[model samples]
Target: MHSGMTDVTFQLRYGSNLTYECSLAADRVVASHLPPPALTDLPARLSEALAAPLEFPALHQAIVPGDNVTIVLERDTPQAGALLAAVWKEIASRGVAPDHLTVLQPASYRSQPPTDPRDALPADVREHVTWKVHEPATEVECAYLASTAAGERIYLAREAVEADFVLTVGELAFDTLLGYRGTSSSLYPGLSTAEALRRSHGQGHDELSPDDQRPLRELTDEIHWLLGGQFSLQVIAADGQNVSAVVAGQADAVLRHGKKLLAETWRFEVPARPELVLVAVEADAGGHHWSQVAAALDAARHIVARDGRIVLLSELEEEATDGILMIRDARTPRDALQPLRQAAPADLIAATQLARTIDWANVYLLSRQDHDLVEDLFMIPLEDENEVDRILDGDEPCAVIGGGQHTLTHLQNR
Candidate 1:
């Protein structure tokens, strides 16, 4: 695909508030993909979605005067605080007292520390709302749900299980484990017991298919059913902190709507495998981490040629995990990955993905970490845009992918 210009300049997003610009030969560019323009009035769109949700009652109609409500949030989602504020205001307007509403969130939405979702609320509203982070390892924090089809016992956060109404707020995007991230995903493995969480971590969907019938998604739906979760709010994000769309209402309806919008916004098709795939992983507020980098690399690997080069640009600063440390100390990638296959840890997928990506292509990572740590992972450390400029100076076919963490690239001839 020709970029239609002699020299194409790209202002790529990096870190929280920085952008790195570079130029590429238009003829050498095989493809370029970016998210659609962000919505100009996000708050109004959110309010409209809540007021007229699909296949479910509006917020005022859904909640009664005395119902105890719990909002389960996927805290790492872009603009999560905005979503929470919109939902909370609608529910509170229905005469539901502040004490009866609780915000239950996962301990760590990403590899880095999370900003409290409730912080988006006004000071008065923030003071009255109850908030707690889910702790998967603590027995006291969980309540027994039903058993799965396999008869494996299921446990979720006590707050979510016991609430009279549960409203799930999560991001809708392609996922390695769940095919596509559904509303229920944030509640089950995210808020479930440590055992369930570990089991979920072990089930990596290497096939990368978006079929709705995948086992993990089925499990998530079943868990949502067991919890009597009927209403949900899901967001599809644009590049960086921008949100492209928001869907609200009945779980299935929201999932259906979200899936369609996700495909239109994030999926891309290339003509052929490029020799070099340049990708940018953006997290607006300092939340960029190793897991997102892994996701971006995984996306790039699908569209790059054998022994091709993948340059990943991010502002990753999260500390190394135990799995990462294992990789750092191992003699070979296989040795580092062998132990992870038995027991799933926090960084199981990330560690394995990084090792596999390096084995397939040369990965250049530009991040805030030290050169020693970058070398430890067998990745070449990228210091500045000069290195990027040097790489682009090659005449090989290249593809530039924006928001690679949420992107799904397919070769047209494949």
Candidate 2:
């Protein structure tokens, strides 16, 4: 903002709510803002959704005694404690033995002392069920299946590929590149090797395009077919981890429900573009990744004008993703993208998306990282807290996004 009010304070969402108190002209331009709906009646609502899964057996009827059932979870799944408890209770009521259950994580980079998923289960269930993480880089962990028309080799954990029934429970959100995320994604690209992922991803899709008519639907539907899945439970959230809705059934059906919720709640429509936008990430510790930052930026771009600037409010505690950290040594945005794609090691999606955002607009990062490292990636780093005041002193307009990482922002007119 070129010239604003006397004092201004914004509770920027970074992991937890970070109070961004600034001295703005009292008359600051608050262009547009939108928050998610209330997350009430979650348990009842989830049960209702499961009650009517599209073209699938009831949760209890589908499972039987002595049946080996594999439950896949995305690393990013939230409120997992509740989902795990619900799944176990439902299946147990159906007479399924805990010993017949297996929990697989295809993209989890767990710590040396992996947090036990069993801790979330009941005492009896914990003793019988098995929980394992899959490493896609290792052939022992990932088995090759078929190839897509795009030649994207389909590779997944052997357990999931050979399972009698493949089921997944995770939260699905609108992805800037992939359209909508859910079960099929949790299995295919989420479970595939780094090389396979590179092929699965093509040039970015037009996000502003109507999501319901997008081609990603067909692609995810095909993946659902390949998986031969029993059911996939997708979650919706209001604010952080406040799961409001749960949709289960086939993959495409899950995706459809998730998209519908996104259109109604997560997606925000703004009247016009702004020259300066401040995007912040205030979710959980998991939201510290570069992918989260990229998503926040992707949301901001919809309401940001050409040649405008974006103030990225990310502590970047997770730093750049393992694959994208090399950008810190690169000299320019072009340099970052070329070598990054050629590397194609891991986190290629996030690394590539970030590099593209840097090239798209003037981005100023509000982070705790080394200034030189931030600048190496062609982004301006505001190491000093007072820098925000200087920017606000200007007369230019600005907008603040409290839930940038999770909110689906779009222009109403565009």
lDDT of 1 at 181: 80
User: Candidate 2 lDDT, tens digit per residue, 184-222?
Assistant: 767765576765555665435644454645555456557
What TM-score does model 1 achieve against the real structure?
A: 0.93
Per-residue CA lDDT of model 1 for 60-99, tens digit only, reads: 7989888999999886777888898898789888888878
Top candidate, metric lDDT: 1
| Candidate that scores best on TM-score | 1
Error of 2 at 100 (Å): 0.4
